[model samples]
Target: MPKRYSPQVRAEAVRLALEHVEAHGSAYAAARAIGPMVGVHYETLWMWTKQALSERAWRAQRGQSGVATPPAG
Candidate 1:
């Protein structure tokens, strides 16, 4: 079975991954670097980051702040 992570953990991982992306190269790299430290799989973290970032961009196009709840999967 897949492991279940809390919303707070998802958010933090997404946040860290984004920061890592800004400082580094790609989201994959961010995930690879941050996942182990946060106890999440790299692929999982990357997906969460991608989703959050896409949502953020979608919200930005409408002039809204990014405060979306990560979707449950």
Candidate 2:
């Protein structure tokens, strides 16, 4: 795997990117706005923001009794 931004820097970049998207309503646009602040390409910034949002959503509903896990095939 390619060495990219530090984890802490990536996380902060993601947070900032999310805020930008939430305010501006577009991930690409947000990435463009945020790319310079952090040393990441717009595509990487967008991917990081998406990954962070997905993780947060997953964590918010983790371990709920009513949620079913699919059986391994």
Q: Best-fitting candidate, measured by lDDT? A: 1
Q: After superposition, how far is residue 46 of candidate 2 from its true place, in Å?
A: 0.4
RMSD of candidates 1 onward, in order: 4.6, 4.1
Candidate 1, lDDT over the whole model = 0.86
User: How far off is residue 73 in model 2, in Å?
Assistant: 18
List clash counts for every candidate, in order: 0, 0
Please give the CA lDDT of all the candidate structures. 0.86, 0.77
Error (Å) of candidate 2 at residue 32 is 1.6
- For model 2 the local lDDT of residue 68 reads 47
Residues forming the 10-long window of minimal summed lDDT in candidate 2 = 64-73
lDDT of 2: 0.77
**Reference-based TM-score of each model:** 0.81, 0.70
lDDT by residue for model 2 over 1-73, one digit each (tens)?
Answer: 8756788888888889988887778887898889887888888898777776666566555655556443322
lDDT of 1 by residue, 1-73 (tens): 9999999999899999999997778988999999999999999999998888787676775565555554444
- 10 residues in a row with least lDDT, candidate 1: 64-73
